[model samples]
Target: MTSNKEDYLKVIYEENGLERPVSNKVICEKLGIAPSSVTEMLSKLQKQGFIEYEAYKGSKLTSIGGVICIKLLRSHRLWEVFLIRYLGYSWREAHEDAHLLEHVAPERMIDRLEAFLNFPETCPHGSIIPKNGELFENTQLVKMTDLKVGDIALLVRVEEDGDLLDYLERSGIIIGEYIKIKEKEEYEGSVEVLQKEKSIRISYKAACQIYVEKRR
Candidate 1:
């Protein structure tokens, strides 16, 4: 009866491979709740053996809860990709709609959808399918703003969860394109970058969040 379970579990699941604690404040922000509410739910979760919670510290899933989180996440992401690639929703609209349906997707439905979608290898945003109880390595990335004069880099990925994400997509910055900082604006921090056939100005804030690979 609570998204609290999936919410906490997913946060823990996401942070498991990262080298940092996703602070209670982060969970608060994600859920749009008071900090105290996060603490209250976390306490309940800890008692349920879903996570080990500490006051003013943070939480991590107990092993049993970890397995559930992984399983549910695999289902949600797989369904999201299926909906977008096969069912005609655009990439941007799917995450929120799928968020609701994903939690209730039946096991049989999941299997049928997977088979029908041909068992996608990756989600639309390019996240890998995590399975077989194996932890995934963090994706390789660097801030797009970090490109220096004459440094060659390719835009590898964009973090897809904010107001600015849609804005970036409309601006023609997407994954798998080569980009370089042609000039850094003196009045503002916009960087001039060239994609395929055109050059455009990208704000410093947007550039900083996108990950890029050094050309080698």
Candidate 2:
């Protein structure tokens, strides 16, 4: 598959397109492309049996498409681990470099890289790396937005967006950190959370992207 096709499939998978139809607008926004272009590509992917597309409703990946995407994700996350752990790349830098590397690296190379990295389970940003074309279940994780005021949770996986990673890093919201929701602004949906004895206020949109495990 071409790199463009792989990117579309990856975006669709990240948007949970397999479980539900992802709107063209969402895809367009994620890819920063025109609506017409998204429509054209979706049609082509559908014709190629990579996806199922419907006007107005949106598109979802087929089983074949999903398998390819999973493999790509595995490659992408493993590269992130290697870049960060060994090359001293920052979280955002690793993600950017991995995005470029995932398209061209052979599967065999990725397999060797994974082993060389000692079989990392998660990427620098805390996303689980798919293994053997299978995505591990993360049923216990909930979005940070789900927590109410005074609730404490353990930050786990974060959505792989470069800006989000940078902002989280600046705020000291790394994986495994404990977050206590100090306040929630009802009007704006923003929440103020305490992490490492520091208060950080994150927007609602950002909270939606961060995943956590609620503490008992």
Q: Which prediction has the highest lDDT against the true structure? A: 2
Best prediction by TM-score: 2
TM-score for each model: 0.82, 0.88
Candidate 1 runs further than 4 Å off: 15-22
Q: How far out, in Å, is residue 46 in model 1?
A: 0.7
Model 1, TM vs. native: 0.82
lDDT tens per residue, model 2, 96-193: 99999999999999999999999988887888888778997678999988999999999988887888888877877668789999999999998899
Candidate 2, position 184, lDDT: 91
Task: List model 1 lDDT by residue over 3-87, tens digit each.
Answer: 6578777876676613334578878777788988778888787788877765656776778777777667668778778777778
Each prediction's RMSD over C-alphas, in Å, is: 2.8, 2.2
Alpha-carbon lDDT, every model: 0.71, 0.89
33, model 2: CA deviation in Å? 1.5
Q: How well does candidate 2 score on lDDT at residue 103?
A: 94
Among residues 3 or more apart in sequence or in different chains, the pairs in candidate 2 whose N, CA or C atoms overlap within 3 Å are: none
